[model samples]
Target: MMTFDPLGDGISRVEHLDHMGDDLRVVNAARISFDRESHLECDDTGQWLQDQDEKLIGFLAENEHVSPFFHPQICLRITMPSFLAHQWWRSTVGVSRSEVYRRYVVAEPQCYQPPHWRLRAQQPKAGSGTGELGAERQAALSVEVERLYRDIRTLYGQMIQEGVAPELAQAVLPQATYTRWIETGSLHYFVRACGLHTGPMAQRELRLYAEAVSEIVGGLFPVSWKALTRHTAA
Candidate 1:
């Protein structure tokens, strides 16, 4: 499994979990619509796409004909902030996720430790944060934040050990708490999701994930990924 660390923070990560289908699959999905099928040519040099089929993928992507892209599937294992995961979970089309249930897992889990605080941005778009706090303020805030998280996790563990319902106790954890999930979705879904998440309006933390996903999916479906993301970025 290939894993990426978000911002080099071990607590936040994305693991490439298996993928189904490929660029050939996407090409065939579109070709079958015309009662034709495309195949990869295999030689002593291994398999490669026919030049025309490659061009067809670019045409489909440029024209926004994305249904064929949906024929390929991708799965990923992600561990990120609870708050960030909540925002990601809002994307429901062509995707499903299974998360670690706090109800059954009572062990104390590590929480996210932001490298520093960011000053909120008031321009370009709303809800975006830009830049960082001064070093002095950043260090002070980090100390206080870590103290708060330590105290909260300690109390949560105590409650669970004393017979408190794990479900109810989980509610007391802060948004910075880390959680894990396995998500499965179509190639088109990832392209769309990464495009949106990498935009300036999304949180910086989300960008880390979006970039990681782009890197992984790009390797899996090079032609389609490039064609799709080129148009998406434009």
Candidate 2:
């Protein structure tokens, strides 16, 4: 399946829809600087292989000349909690997003229900801590969350029946509500995104999504992906 279960949350997924360009695109983009392009300019059969110029790619990467990486773009369809989507929305460069609108469609409501709930960070109002809630507490929380969503869905449908605008009705849903969107971005953007989200500050769920992205993008643009990420994350 194209769908990826990054956190193993059944409601969330990341699906690679399509992609454009390749390593040669990067090579040609770079060579364009000197009015040159890499194609079948040589009779050597190896020249027809990937990367075309490994040293040149490495040089560009080591020197941080990454504009060529922008030539390749990847598309993904992601389903995640609205809160996590808010975090991703911060990435506004070299990427575009088109999301499912609640006002237009009355899709079934779903929410993220982690098997083990995370504890709040030690510092006041920071991110989550390394530990998880005890199994007993986790079970209790699940029950409460299920009840809460059940009530929310009931209220939302009631409002819709009473002729309340769908937009206003959707406002009743919390950040935990699941949302879906289409994301398209350059190779460099995905690499940078994976690097950042896999870091300490990002949420655990978002980091998992980024790891899924790294796996796909890394496979798509192995050499250039490595150059940008340096294998430090994912």
Candidate 3:
């Protein structure tokens, strides 16, 4: 599970890419209110990331009809694999991610909250849908998940006692293992990337996260956010 923190100082400026010709003074005010600096250091590496973000924003502004919005930084707490994290990093979006390290942070038995909508079909080969399991079934699945989680943790401890390397034993960890990260980015890229991953009736956890970001950005830049939301929803 990821946690969120308020954006701090010197990092609250909002960048706008709009062709609407409206002054958007109201939106600008909101941006000023929502802006915050990320905790990450602004070293050479950080400067490079910021440069890339500016380049992308400039490109979109010059070429695309849709306006874009970006805060100086974004904070995201996400739990995903190193592999997936690498993919996200490639976007060159101005977002920062912080994750737990196996070397520095001790591994704990992983727990995952089952999606409420997955009840009707515990294993949807085609993927999640609106159909969900009944209350009775959901309760049963919850018990099973808890039971399995405890069992897995116990086994992991036993493996350690038997001299298994932590890294090797970690391989048995399930994908559902919860992880957290903090990501920061331009609203333009954030919305675009999220739109690509989401479909109707997205998983509640991810959808809620996306929606929260959307709401934040939308409140800051109403016109641009509205257009983006309408386009994505359509």
Candidate 4:
């Protein structure tokens, strides 16, 4: 029995499959139950586990193309920053994002780990990379960034301890700090707005998020994803 941990990835779980049409509706509903019960502590844990195993097998039993459900839409939760979120929000095609509010629900800020390749000589103003840096340079930059991150976290904790409101304290946090949002959109809208036609840099983070969404949707609506990808690429 190979148990899988969904939370290990930034993507936790996907639940909406009404977007994959009636043919997949029954199995998608079953999957929702399976996912929920699997996470819950049922008294008959063995039976619950067995049920999920059977449901998974059944879900994979059929291999027929079906019309994709376009109206209901799918929602994805993504962790990114205000700036990236701003960039993502620019696409007017069917995408909607609800982000963490600075006005409420404040906590210690989250952040992104920059790829190690960005530290060399600041690169061209246009931000193109020449090549990788040596180990010595990488190591030095890593140490400095880690130290700064640690210090910021420490200061954040101290401010909280000293009775600063989390919203106010978060002012000290960098724009690089992580934020999260729930993005919802139709498959056509999502794929078109986030497709390869978009500039590589403009779409980077959202593209990764879109890819994850595509994986889930593609699993249920393979033909639709393929069509959408083709259209976008074309």
TM-scores, all candidates, are 0.94, 0.90, 0.56, 0.61
* Model 1 regions lying over 4 Å from their true place: 124-129
Q: Best to worst by lDDT, what's the order?
A: 1, 2, 4, 3
Candidate 2 clashes between residue pairs 3 or more apart in a chain or in different chains: none
Model 4 global lDDT (CA atoms, 0 to 1): 0.54
- Per-residue lDDT over 211-230 for candidate 2, one digit per residue giving the tens place of the 0 to 100 score: 88888888888778777787
Q: Give the clash count for each candidate.
A: 0, 0, 17, 2
Give candidate 2's total backbone clashes: 0
Give the per-residue lDDT digits (tens) of candidate 4, residues 1-234.
111212234433334323424223433444564564323225744312244533443333333211232443666666655555666566666667677886576566665555555433353432434556787888888788767877888898798889888778888777667676667776556656556324444334455555555566556545445544554431
Q: What lDDT does each candidate get?
A: 0.88, 0.83, 0.49, 0.54
Cα TM-score of candidate 2: 0.90
Model 1 is weakest, by summed lDDT over 10 consecutive residues, at: 122-131
Q: Please give, for residues 127-184, the per-residue lDDT of candidate 3 as tens digits.
A: 5555778888888988887788788888877887797877788776665564445556
Which ten-residue region of model 2 has the weakest summed lDDT?
Answer: 40-49
Q: Select the stronger candidate by lDDT from 2 and 4.
A: 2
Tens digit of lDDT per residue, candidate 1, span 101-141?
A: 99999889788888878887767574656678999999999
Candidate 4, 153: how far from true, in Å?
Answer: 1.4
